[model samples]
Target: MIRGVRGATTINQNTEKEIIQRTEELLLKMIDANAIVAEDVAQVLISVTNDITACFPAKALRNLDGWDYVPVMCTKEIAVPDSLPSCIRVMMTVNTEVAQKDVNHIYLYAAQSLRPDLSKS
Candidate 1:
């Protein structure tokens, strides 16, 4: 079945290094928590808050081994009033034997506030 894993994190700043680092941290946690392998990933969709324009989160994934073949895209999130700032979110589509209910989603840092119901915190 094609399952989806969701994750989100916040960066302290909008710099390229901060964005990339935070994105990498979020992706690694999501991938590890869900046992996601490169071959199983169909695509990754990343969205960042409008305030974060320094770099694309997808660029960070390119540095991962075997991620070069995976399709990744990034876009700006819809600007909503009172929304979390400097946030990066990801929805990864993957072919997995795991049931939908078994999938583990990750939310880190201040982004945890965005999904209190699903968060492990």
Candidate 2:
């Protein structure tokens, strides 16, 4: 079955280290939570808020996971007022036997503040 597994998190600061750290952590959790092996993943799309630019979150995933064949794209999220800055979000499509409800999306760092309600769900 093809399904989407979502995960998101944010950097508390506007530095490169914070961006890479948070993104790598979130991606790992998302994959682990759904028991998604790299071979099972179809594609990954990363959406980040406007405040961040130095590094792409997808690069962090590649360096960490060694998934060179899995396609990953990055885009800028719509800029909104009073929203979380330095936030990186991911939507992953995978071929999995797991149900949609069985998927556990991860939220960490400042991104936790963006969607506390979703996390609780």
Candidates' lDDT values, in order?
0.93, 0.82
TM-score of 1: 0.97
- Per-residue CA lDDT of model 2 for 1-121, tens digit only, reads 9999888887777677878888888888887778888888889999999988878777787775558899999999999998887789999999988887877877787677766865742
Worst 10 residues of 2 by lDDT: 112-121
Model 1 lDDT tens row, 48-90: 9989999888988998998999999998899999899889999
- Kindly report which residue stretches of model 1 are placed more than 4 angstroms away from their true locations once superposed: none
- Top lDDT model: 1
Please provide TM-scores, in order, for all candidate models, with all chains considered together: 0.97, 0.89
Off by over 4 Å in 2: none
Clashing pairs in 1: none
Clashes of each: 0, 0
63: Cα error in model 2, Å: 1.4
